[model samples]
Target: MSENKNYQHPDVQKAENDELEIDWMEILRKIIAIRKTLYKAAGVGMVLGIIIALSIPKQYTVTVTLSPEMNGDKASGGLASLASSFLGGGTSSNNDALNVTLAPDIVSSTPFVLDLFDTRVQTLDGKLDTTLVSYLDEQKQPWWGYVKAAPSLAIGAIKSLLTEEADSTAALNPFQLTEKEATKVKGLRQAITANVEKKTAMTTITVTLQDPKVAAIVADSVVAKLQQYIVDYRIKKAKEDCAYLEELYKERQQEYYDAQSKYAHYFDTNRNIAFQSIRAEQERLQNDMSLAYQVYSQVAQQLQVARAKIQEEKPVFAVVEPATIPLYPSGISRKIILIGIIFLTICITGGWKLFGYSYWLKIKKMI
Candidate 1:
């Protein structure tokens, strides 16, 4: 009984409980003990990050905004041309509204991007100038490029041996792109972006490049080219309309002259005759001549209108904001990247000490 009492004593009970319970303070101390190791890992990570960030070339971005001219009731002109007297309202027409709507599609098209590959721009230092395609090909590659370069070289060699063509002339055919030019165009598409606002109908184009001046120049050129493309598309249809109207007018004019000549010949031949048959024939010929004159006049008027509309059909672009030379590089900050890497490294190091060591032990046991 005395032994049992000793075993159940308060001091002994307290000691047993103390042994079973966790010592959070001691665990905290253990974590704090490795603070130097954690900081060293973090410092190493930060140094590596700084090195990587410094190696990457800075890129600059330029943005331009344009408002396409909106014609109220674009289809009204075509409707009027088909039936003007039948449904009389406006004298004007909008035969080329499709060109206005498809403006964005033209900007992002592969052929359009390919065209820009030939565009020339100055480098960051302004000491060197080169084409866009050459610049991208010559500039610094991504970190993973070394891994991909081997496969790319092998594939290129295989393709070259398989391909019979000596040059990329066939690639110039917009429908079939050569592998090299296609790759370049794909990269270019990444650099240029075109967006249109549905409600406001305003277009915004952004160009990103290694050089600030080059970015601005490309963006400005894109806007101008887009406007020109739309104008050309619109003019093509307008010119066709003018040609058809001109041909129709000439045909009608000839018919009118022939009818007038026949009527005059009948009048001169039947001047002294008073027969009912001759008189009826004369009236019919006069009516035919009058109908031909009316058609000729109406067709001549439409020809003039068609010519006038061609001038009106040309697309007008309102430059809301033009691209300007960028003063600063729009790339990720080296300091921020370095600091982030340091912080992540510290957290990982601390976590490894707290929990990863146990996981590693379990993994080792399993192994």
Candidate 2:
């Protein structure tokens, strides 16, 4: 009775400090035991990774690097064709990435992507390819594309997918686009990447294909086609520049003629005192000639630049390191994945041990 009273009395009660002590050796033994039990799951995971790594088809990447033409006046014949137009416009075209930012509302608009269908590729024979007729077939989406989890569903969908794969070629034309050619354009648009280096004339482009040869061909073709596009675009601009400069040059010439004509009339009228006022008149003529010369020099420089651009014969793409087929899979990081699996296994085993401990305590209470 007295012992029981002492245990219940607040004054006699002793406070117990709670502490947890882990036995490292025991924990290690438990972990080893857990691994032995889970050895089958671990083996299954490793096998699955190896199989997945090998099952994926190899894809090759092809790339081209270009040093874009600078907006400079080097008096080169190739650039002279555009100098006038560029000067008139007061600015250059919005760069590749900047196109989206320039018109954000229309960048992702459906009309824009659909409008791409209107552009067609013309072959050397000047006829549209029949391959463009099946453009709508590209819209066939992968099954379970939106459903991320349960990849098996997507695989099942892909097997029976009613999709047409686009065959892109160098002959593809941008002007003769039709409904049939829309799919090819869409596919091309997606597979292509264009990036320009900041504050420099460097541009990089990449294209991917299942066949290594096709990848290389597509990359080279894009480089060729794009050069033509730039040259034509430049030529048109140069003509405009030439026209503007011609008009400005005429205006300056008229002013120069009027200045000369005025000085002549004054000299004839003041012939009696021509020698007396000759110094003042000479100073005035010098100032006018200097101003006229400055304007003529500036306009002449612009005209020369435009002429140079029209004569560019070849596209200039400085090839850095061209892309090659990747030897290792870039999709999966095996070491990182294995480490994650090991961590999860440890958590699950720890939970199981806790569950068993609680069950044993309950059984002892019953006994």
Candidate 1 C-alpha lDDT tens digits along 1-367:
7767546778888987786665766678778899899879888988888877777777888989889887565445543344444433236544444635565677779878877877787876787688777777776665666667879879889988997756633346678776777777877788888888878888889898887888887898898888877777777876898899899999999999999999999999998999999999999999999999998888877776667667766767899999998898886777887888888888888889878998999999999
Each model's TM-score? 0.77, 0.44
List pairs with backbone clashes in candidate 1. 77-93
Error of 2 at 208 (Å): 2.4
Against the true structure, candidate 2 reaches a TM-score of 0.44
RMSD of 1: 6.1
- Give lDDT tens digits, candidate 2, residues 60-100: 56667776545543333334335645554232332232221
Candidate 2 at residue 303, lDDT?
A: 57
Model 1, residue 253: C-alpha shift (Å)? 3.5
- lDDT of candidate model 1 versus the reference: 0.79
lDDT (C-alpha, whole model) for all candidates = 0.79, 0.52
